[model samples]
Target: MKDFIKFLRLDSLCGQLVAIAVLSLAALQCVNYYAVYSIQQSYASEFLSVGHDYLASVCQALAHMSAAEREDYLASLDRSRGALAKPFRFRAAEAPEWETETDYYKSVLAREAVTEILTRAGIPPRDVRARVLYGDSPEASEPHFAGYVFPMMQMLVQDGGGSWLELVQPLSVTDRRLIWRQRIFIMAESLICFALVIIFIVRAMLPLKRLGESVERFGANPETASPLPERGNYEVREVARSFNKMLARVQRNLTERDNMLEAMGHDLRTPLARVQLRLDSIEPPELREKFAANIEEIRSIVEQGLELARSLRTSEKAVPMDAAAFAASVADDMAANGGAVTFAEAADCGEPPLVAARPTCLRRAVENLACNALKYAGGAELSVERRGESVIIRVEDRGPGIPPELLEKVFEPYFRVEGSRSRGTGGTGLGLTIARNMVLLNNGFLTLENREGGGLRALITLPALKTAKIGEIRS
Candidate 1:
């Protein structure tokens, strides 16, 4: 149930469109149903009024005839061995339910037509009674229009010829033909209305669909993503335009940083070379060695700064790669370089898990961590495993762990630990910062924590998304 509701959530444009259409259709159906009874009744009542008027005329004709002539006149209209107008007790004028105001089918039109008819015939209002009924009822007591077999009306008139008169007439105004005609009309109306509504909704939401696709494509690779079309509703077009502006700004900043790094590479290296040359001309051999070492230290710092800038301008693309193999290769490479790194694979890592990554940038991140471990702890233990939908890469070192307060601060650029991994080891201090940024670029995160015993552990958690792209953040 929750999943179904989530599917219908109005956060999406399609969901909202469907919801609105359904509600509108339901309301239309309700109104159509409610109007059915009234429309049918009104049409049938018009014919019912005609029947009453005919009955009144018959009574008026009989009143003008002498007692002897009335019998002969009535016989002239007889058919099917029955009289059309029959005599009855006028005392039952108030007995019919339809004559009462509570009658559903009774309307002002029927009443006015009947009243005018009776008055023109010189009949007192109190001397007449009229009602309409359905043919299915035993009390129909009228000549129902056999062609329709619907409801009917009854009338009783006081006769001036020493007898009471009663008349039966069919209230056959609206029949199957009329009702079916109305039905077809309503069906066509509803169909056209809903068709227009659905078409409008689809067209209106087309741009939203395009926007969603653009966002998905953008998140796949921010560096090389194409701008979304600025063709939609006002709000959607604005969003696309804003995203294009933002992407352009990011691209511009990255270009500027790269240019600065290139200029620094050329301008700073010549000065360092000139200083080394000057030291080469020193008189004492011991003094020359000391000065040369200091110069080398400065050169190393310069090189590290360049490397940090290079990390910032990294343009590596992401692709699916085996997590276990990647982690194993990083450790192997470090050990081959005499960095004292060892690799371990968890039992769960039997089948290599694939993750989206930029291999070169990701490798640099792990290398920096391993090298940092070697400086403080002399050795590093690396392990890779799969945990649910995520892959974990942990690098552990048996060194004095960083202080709790400085754990977050250690990720800041140029932040070096004060203990075993101090400045004496010669570092630019941007290792952790660069490593974390690289991990983030690959849709992963890095964290540091002290081991249960006495060591520090760097854990990299990468979500197992084969299509995950580099240099993109999920908004």
Candidate 2:
């Protein structure tokens, strides 16, 4: 129950509104039902005129009958119906005690109605008594109808020998059930309508949902993002219009930024060449090499900055390609270039898995992880394995693993681990960041963790391919 409630997203305005509406309707329905019921049970105040007149007439007719005629008429009436009618002394009767407010009302009203009838008939009222009770056969008792209070009338007389007359009003069990059935049917109809309204409301908000998706897509790939439609209610339409305007402005800014970075990098090459020539003229050999190395670092930084800037633009489009085969090729290329990289076969499938990814970007991310493994662990093993609908490419090495605290920090741009910031590391600290960004743009994830055997492992899992465009890949 707690889990169910925890999962309920009442933070959403739509969910909160629907919950309030349904609860309010249900509370109103319950109150309406109870109000009607309380009023029905309080029927004693309404003065049941039909029952009062019938009881009076029966008493007047009985006063005119002879003893034998009264007995014969009563016998005939007993055979036809269960309405018991006779006169009895007031002392020889069982009095019913009223337990509830409704019962007390019935008792008081029955005594008053009976006394008035007898006094008008020239009979002393003090010698007469009346009581109201409910008639239900013990054999036919049921939980549902046990509390069904049906009114019954009983009167006693003490003119001669004690006797009594009882009149029980007939009740229709089916008719009582029909009243509840009608109420239930109405409630069911109301709930059905409410559900339909909820469904329509959700469908009507679909355009807003689509707009959210478009915004996220643009954030991921601003260069290649398509414009969202100006469809939906007024608020959604306004939001879409504003979002399109913002998207266009951002794209223009990014294009300008990329162009400026390229120009700056291009212009720095000449100054770097001049500095390298100037450093060659130093007198001390060691100092000259050190200055040349510093100049080299500057050049490397400029080239890496340009590469990182270019990678930030996610213009590459994904297509269906062999993911495993692609990783194997990267390993083969690194091996050819004097790097110790080799591919491993998956235990499941012999064939490389086909996935939707940009070949250049995907290869670059894997190549970066492989280079990290070779540099830190001295050698690297690459494996592409299928894990259900996704494919994971594992890059493992047998070198000193990163500190648990600084594992995530290694992926930050321009961040270097302690004692690894020199030219020996062969990076300006943008490799992992660029690789992770490329993986993310292709709808994949990249993570690093310490392998079990004193080494680091990098995993890049790509989502399974479903559909792809048949045209040439975007770059």
Candidate 3:
């Protein structure tokens, strides 16, 4: 049921269009069926009325004719019957089967109509009888129309000689097969129209879909978001034009901000360098050491502030890389630097877990997590694995885990846990913030959770590249 709902995607425009089309078709079919049924009822009623009048006239004409001329007159009338009209077969008999089975004919309307017409013509109602017979009856030899049985009217009138005049005529009614064929044709036509409408609507809305995808891509990595084509309807084209203009403005603003930060860093570092040189000439060694420590802290803060700004607006182009190999490389580099970081290889899968990432930015984010573990926990373990369409990179430590409430607060810039994690550990409080921004820039997610027993787990989830795309990249 969930899969079916997902497939419908009623949240989207295309799904709404399909739903509307189906409902319209259903309503139209219902109207069509009612119209066909009403028309059949009206036509059948009119035919029966005309049939009663014609039968009565024929009986009256036969009453006036001599016994010898009656047969000749019937023959002439049969010959004059139109091709489209049903022929009335007349014969003189003692007692027909229809007369004996009077109770079997259950059509009260037809019998009453025949009796009324005969009585008005001066013939006694007792001398005239009418019955309806279906084509399937044993006494009826008439063939069916398109495999459908129709009722035939059988009438009997007693002449002056007391001989019974038997008349059998087919009821004028619409064929069931023809009505079904018309319905089938209408349904086919409606389906064709529905398909054409859906195609037109989808094509018209295609530009909107592309625009939404472009916006999402720009949010993930502005550098990789290309300008959308200014085609389709006028409104769509205008929206694309506006989006392109916005992208240009944002890029310009980022560039100007970077230039301003670079200038400020250069100007501040010059004065800080001069201060370091002057600190060496201080009288007391302890006072000089304290001054030097403060200056170094200031310098670290300045550099980290610049690094945080850079992480938000990376110009690095993302490329597909093996996540397992990348995690291992980071771990090996940290181990070489005497950080006590261990690399755990993932289980051998048929294909390497590949993710699209900016190498420098992603590496810095991973390194920040590892460094935090090494500072507090004294050691860190790095591992990578593929789970479904995502590649997960985890940094685990056996440190005293953070408080549940403060776990999310640590990600906020300049916010630090004061209990387990103190200011003495020395962080500008922007490490997690910077890491999260960098991961988001690569369209990945980073989350911190306390491990079982005692420890903290830093997990990064990146979208895995398809095997086909990996082959294209390698080629």
Which has the higher lDDT value, candidate number 2 or candidate number 3? 3
Per-residue C-alpha lDDT of model 3 across residues 298-326, encoded as one tens digit per residue: 89888877877687776787888988889
lDDT of 1 by residue, 78-129 (tens): 4422432322111212234334333544534455566688687677663555
Judged by whole-model lDDT over C-alpha atoms, candidate 2 comes out at: 0.69
Candidate 2's displacement at residue 76, Å, is 4.3
In model 1, which regions exceed 4 Å deviation? 1-99, 102-127, 130-226, 229-242, 280-294, 314-319, 336-352, 377-381, 385-392, 396-409, 417-422, 440-475
The C-alpha RMSD in Å for every predicted model, in order, reads: 8.3, 6.5, 6.4
The alpha-carbon lDDT assigned to residue 137 of candidate 2 equals 44
Between candidates 1 and 3, the one scoring higher on TM-score is 3
Q: What is the lDDT of residue 126 in candidate 1?
A: 37
Model 2 off-target regions past 4 Å?
1-7, 10-15, 35-50, 53-73, 82-103, 113-163, 169-176, 179-183, 186-248, 270-295, 336-338, 349-354, 385-390, 466-475
Error of 1 at 17 (Å): 8.3
Q: Please write out the lDDT profile of model 2 over residues 33-57, one tens digit for every residue.
A: 7765555444433434445566566
> Which 10 successive residues of model 1 have the least lDDT summed?
84-93
Best by lDDT: 3
